[model samples]
Target: MTANDTDTDVLIAGGGLAGATLALALARMVPQLRVTVAETFPLASNAEPSSYQPSYDARSTALAWGSKMIYDQLGLWPALAQHAAPIHHIHVSDRGHFGAARLHAAEYRQDALGYVVDNRWMGLCLVRELLKTQVQWLAPAEVTDMTCHGDNVRVTVTTAGETRELSARCLVVADGGRSDLRERLGFQVRHQPYGQNALIANVTTADSHQFSAYERFTDSGPMALLPHGSPTRASHQSALVWTLSDSELKEVLAMPDADKCTRLQKRFGWRLGRFTRIGECNHYPLALTLVDNPVRPGVALVGNAAHSLHPVAGQGFNLALRGLMTLVEQFRLAGEQGSNPGELAVLQRYQQLHRSDRVQTAGFSDSLIQIFGSPLAPLTAARNAGLMGLDLLPAAKRWFAGNAMGLGGRKARIQRPGFDNSKALNHD
Candidate 1:
């Protein structure tokens, strides 16, 4: 296969959430550009029984209000709204301390602070929307090698039993945190391990959650419980993210279900009533992985591939969505100007536009983990005071809430326009 074999303007590697969403966004925003997504996992129908994707597994994500806007623009909210649980309030407190802060949706005049959607459901919605677009899908396929040229990128992909070279003006890598493609390209990254693991599970409580979320800073780490499922569901449940040390996590995972629930209740207290039952639990090592530069000639990285942050604030996915919006905007402009999407200038503009948001969001989450995890008496006291001050100060509370809701900073909206084929031109 050569550049003339396939007419893909933008070829995306890794058809997980980010890649799939990007394909869909580009299709909607720049419909004239042909996009192809090559994924390592088989198509849903062709997937083997043992195939399990961590990013799209049993875990759940809290979608901030800003994320909701993106979904609304994509016309996907209606499909996902059914399975999502709205977060009407957020309660932040320090365990065994007097300092606490509460943020209510009513205060911001919004229906909910955020929403909790299971990844499985979210993936289904995205794939369904993707199938309706013109983007070509390649699954059970992996990119073996890639070479960048002045005007295009040549990607060698292995699918089924053959290797083929596909060409595109630009390539978007969303292969995730441990990205082989990124490593092959020699992109430098900064990684910091927190020596913590997040144990996630869905739990049913004796009382209703009323769509409120809780973030409790404990001696071990921060534990968060976000309401899950709709109010009409038969059982009241919430998603639990418990951070524990490596040793503590091993011991907890080895415990029997009954024992695990008991220990969890002891640590979490009676905030949401007794823990009746918990579903299967999964663990993820916590770390901060940041790419020094997320863009290269004819290439761009999104989601975990570019920056993977600790899940303390649940801003990882939300931040990625914002970045995607920015990338789409840049692509749309390039298309109109009939410029090469792979040009260094176009990629640099995206980097400059998104740098501040990435830095601020990553720093905010990292700071929370460090400050709350500190055992020093003075630092603990100061953190406690900070929490109380946030609660008492309306302006400060609003500022904090805005960032948490993903509404702070420059806003990017998806541009919906009729496809203009005349504006789309070949790179070389």
Candidate 2:
């Protein structure tokens, strides 16, 4: 039950996006370190590409600029570029209101405010990067059991009908929002369900999206239009995320695509012109879940295992990448200090580094969701007033844009070609 009882630098559970990327980051940062990832999914292969048809998932993600920076560092952006589209502007409004506040890339002199990417395509691209790294890929493997000792962790995994013991100085859990590992380890998390479900689908619009994103708050919930590329049949397309009350979700899900499109078109109005067709629709329940603490001695939780927020703000992946950045950087510094990368001190450094950013972003997201989702008349007036105030303050607008791009979080500086590393100190 101890790392000294076995071998390896670190053991990562769940080789999804977070686990794979963390391994990739650690390999790049600490080249000599041994990082093994245990994943139940089949190893990604060129023949079996991880492409999700809109007719299957109908869901996509918006990655902030900061997340793009991480992808750029991991050499994933180039591969994702073909399928990803940049959102140059964002329009936010109340459904019953006429004026909508717009945030434009031109105002910030930036190429794009953020990017919209198909989640499956992103996974495929990340898997490709992981393949190029030296990190050990334990695929088709399930963690049957795990235990932690004073300074190390031991894990038992079953792969290909055989059991194997894996020991490491620390364990990283990145399973998902409902992490089985976390539950098995007796970690307590607070989960708040919104009693709403997001109905996702791809819609063909008469007018082009013009690379702009839209978020409209209706009485039911928030509806987002993420600009997408041309449809499969050479038509203007946009990804829809329509959040509805639980009762409404069931009604919408039962309708055929044509009927769903008709209802959506009526509810959404003709802003993007009439939605001619709907590709596929799926429902996802909205919830807020967070672990009390991310770190406990030899254990650490990364990505969704640590926290899951409402998708309205598109901060889930951004927060995960941010955590990865901090952890990898801490490992780098630990190695430089002649210490084991997965030791308690090193792990604590990683935890402390991300605490501030995590708390701030989570609270910010909670406040925004609660304020905007409320039907209180006074709060509604205040919300509009706040938007109007933001419109008047150029500096505030820029800051908001920066935050949406994930730049509001602490950013680690990458040493340049001629920079003096000895003189540089950790900014945070």
Clashing pairs in 1: none
Candidate 1 lDDT, 1-428, residue by residue in tens:
33344468899999988888888889988898889999998778723222333231267889998888788878888877877788988999889899998998877667788899878777888887888888898988997778975578888999998999888888899999889999998889899999999999988889888898999999999999898877344336888999999999999999998888898998888988898887889889999999979898889988999999888688899889888888888898998898777778898888898888888889889999999999899989999999999999977887788778875544422111453322431111
Report every candidate's CA lDDT: 0.83, 0.76
What residue runs in model 2 are displaced by over 4 Å at the alpha carbon? 1-6, 47-58, 230-235, 411-428
Report the Cα lDDT for candidate 2.
Answer: 0.76
lDDT (C-alpha) at residue 166 in model 2? 76
* Every model's TM-score: 0.91, 0.90
How accurate locally is residue 92 in candidate 2, as Cα lDDT from 0 to 100? 80
How many backbone clashes does every candidate have?
0, 0
Colliding residue pairs in candidate 2: none
